[model samples]
Target chain A: MIEVSEAGLLRRRSVVPALLAERGDMLVVAGLGAPAWDVTAAGDHDLTFPLWGAMGGAAVIGLGMAIARPDRRVLVLTGDGEMLMGVGSLATIAVQAPPNLSIVVLDNERYGETGGQRTHTGMGVDLVGMAIAAGIPQTMRINLPGEVEALRQAIHTSTGPLFAVVKIDPESLPLALPPRDGAVLSARFRGALLGPAAHLE
Target chain B: MAGKDWPAALFALLQAHRVRQVAVVPDAGHAALIRLVEASNEMRLVPLTTEEEGIALLGGAWLGGQRGVLLMQSSGVGNCINMLSLAASCRIPLPMLITMRGEFGEFNPWQVPMGQATPTVLEAMGCAVRRADAPEDVAPVADAMLGLAYNTFRATACLIGQRVLGAKTFGIAPQ
Candidate 1:
């Protein structure tokens, strides 16, 4: 849970693009709703799997991908509401401790899709604290624009299971939706990672 | 007709299927198989805080070109209801081995509700559900479940009946 005024939080649109800038060969799993839009706005790629409605699954999905391909980095970009729903997964990920995985929660402190209901983070639930307590070796709470670069660098180079919560201002933005078909998304991702013939398997 | 060897036989089946990851929520009914998975050099045992994570985890594993399975009890199946949509929507090949509880010879009254509803709920969510009441049927049924899942990219589960798993007793400890 987080407790801070929305006075100086980074804008999500600016922050997501910055986090994804110069992204090369990194496999991304975006959480449902706004985080999905945020990633799509940054730029959609075959390697990116933007979830339509697996509300609490982004991190663990990255965990599976990270475990399967240790050579590639996996990033899970999600929102605070989604992260809280699957908070127990932090413990699961920590135990696995995949060096190639990183999770970044975009904390707007509101369930953006559900008519802006205040999430626990708005009332001061520390997600980073939960991550640390769950035994994740690296944890960061990014409240500034400069910190995003550090988080991005960590995603590409750090030995992690790293967890970061970027505190962003809750401004409902225009939808940048990815393809709604899960099969197509899954097929494209697999085709890019493996080959075009891989999905047929 | 098999002896008390279905757990080991089941492990053999998983190994034969090339199941590289075992996503499990610890259940006493699954203890023997869990022990085998723990000892196997070829399998990565992922202990989950809850069962739902297994659905997404295995889906990701499949995305990265690895096969996996989930092992849990009936109660945990309830936790996986919403997450099962990931498998259904993505056409993820999810094979699950679930040991039954709160059905036959169950001493705990609390286990009954979910246990009775397990198969129905799974079926409602588009899982091809099967059951094995005898020791000999366990491995074969599971093999069929896995075959259907991976071959068709469908989520399937084999519910190992309480009779096969041996129901939990709540009586006083033996002196």
Candidate 2:
């Protein structure tokens, strides 16, 4: 059995906004389920691309964005379950090693969307270890709220493919859903990123 | 065009189409194209562990205003099924170059099922499928598919036949 350190477990609501506060020109990719809600709850922006159902793809998507727009910072916020599903992406991203990309896994230790079932993280799967092994330049496991500021700083300003596993309380929150229409969401994001010329295309 | 010229010609076409990213799950059939992409400093080659990651990667690439292609074997198609929904629903441009398996001079029984199902499955997921059975057909089919994908924001697949890839011999020693 894996023991979670509950003493300093951060609330998803507070942590997400704190990380995203004053985020300017940052393109965000939220993994499906809870992380999507967390990002929307923080504040839905035209630049935020909240995924509806792509379970294990958030990081690689962020990598694509980082590669495409090298000038902008790309942050992927996903759940531990989602991160574990696409863990191999760490190696892929590491090889490219785009300096503009950062991935944060909200480690709630359970698959919150699928009835709170315990995930591999709860069974002692270390995402940070896996990322480090995969050659990511920076890796962190954030168990305390104090560590969040440094993680947030690293996310906003780091020359790296940075990986952070943020331990959050598993307590379910109210669903703060984004628009369900994938096309609309994508168009809006592209418009926000590329301006009005995006819609002309 | 000779058999060896197809890969280089296809690479040239991808560059012409502004495909800056190439996501691939390494396969023997894609070896030539992969080598060209790797050797070129102009394109970024993303090596994926599974084929499904390529689907999402291409979606994100399109969203960021960069074109990309997914290269994989027929067997990897099964891995991409669920992820294809993202592209199909959002109208993300996905250009897939899949090498055929289990259709001609077959040695492995394991490759048949998904290989046969590739077209139907991709079509059902809203991808336009086109096949290339000979060396000469490769470039034109790829060019047409890339145009369909990027121009109309449609997911397209160009399935290169096993005959074009040269069927693998049975019981070959490991290199």
Candidate 3:
């Protein structure tokens, strides 16, 4: 069970699973560290390509997936620190506006990997506002436990290049790491997506 | 001569290879080819805010069964150092077409340091680096880079020299 305060923070462990519930054929790109663990904890599918590195690249990778596979939904799960590094990508994504793409920032407001240091979001930087300013058609600032369902629904059914910032409780949890080998991860993902074509070229 | 129409020739080569995505951080040297890619119905031109985004985007494109190429200026190479690790580590087939700056033509002082460091940096990151000093060399170098990248699943870069792109000139303001 998770509790939401007036300060508006939800547990990452709960919110991630809620959002990924019944994730039918969605291709997911998870950022390095906690987001990667978060997605793996939800369930490690061949469809989920969890990054061990490339800290700022999660959202753009999702953009490429959305563009390449218009028939499939693409979701990027990342943290506030990672998202800030690649903030410039929002402008590029806004212009492309791939309807199948959705980027969710789990704003724990701290870099959980680097000894839980305070990130810009902890100091009151607004990721949702940045996304809105970048012209993403749908932007969500999800703060309460009750609001998780709406986000899950929106992810399942929405006309979007949507951006959502979930204010997550900055509590470090035990590791749930996916396979660390990038080549293996890549081959599995490509094979799952492209089938025989992946083996060819 | 191949030199006179290498941009078009290069675009045709990319098309022949079925490069569905063209990722670029717009550079004046790539203007002619960018126009061709933009006008093509076969490819989608993705304008990136920085060179690193192209690296990640193209990596994802490959994951989704589409081939992509990145075009950037030499100075932008410095921005891609950390991100290039993704391509190298993942063994993603990344073919980068880079235009040289800060070398040759005696131009801006700021661009020189990065321009000089470009090849060494890329090589250090485990990317195969190639050079094209003449217009005729551009297509061949790019073709080889594409082959090396796709066939071997390696990160490769073809640095088109400043002479091939023609030196950028400085002058008085145009009214």
lDDT (Cα, 0-100) at B169 in candidate 1: 79
Model 3, position B93: C-alpha lDDT score: 92
Off by over 4 Å in 3: A1-8, B172-175
Better of 1 and 2 by DockQ: 1
* Residue-wise C-alpha lDDT for candidate 3, range A1-201, written one tens digit per residue: 456644557989888888888998899999999999998987899989999889789999998888899999899999999999999999999999999899999998899999999999889888889989999999888888888889888886788899999988888899998999999999999988888779787
- Candidate 3: residue B147 Cα off by (Å): 1.1
Error of 3 at A21 (Å): 0.9
Residues A57-142, candidate 2, lDDT per residue (tens digit)? Answer: 99999999999999999999999999989888998899889999999999999999889999999998889999999999988888
lDDT of each: 0.92, 0.89, 0.91
Clashing pairs in 2: none
TM-score of each: 0.96, 0.95, 0.97
DockQ for each of the predicted structures, in order?
Answer: 0.82, 0.71, 0.82
Error of 1 at B116 (Å): 0.4
Q: Write the per-residue lDDT of candidate 1 for residues A10-63, one digit (tens) a residue.
A: 888888888888889999999999999989998889999999987788899999
lDDT of 3 by residue, B17-50 (tens): 7899999998899999999999999899999999
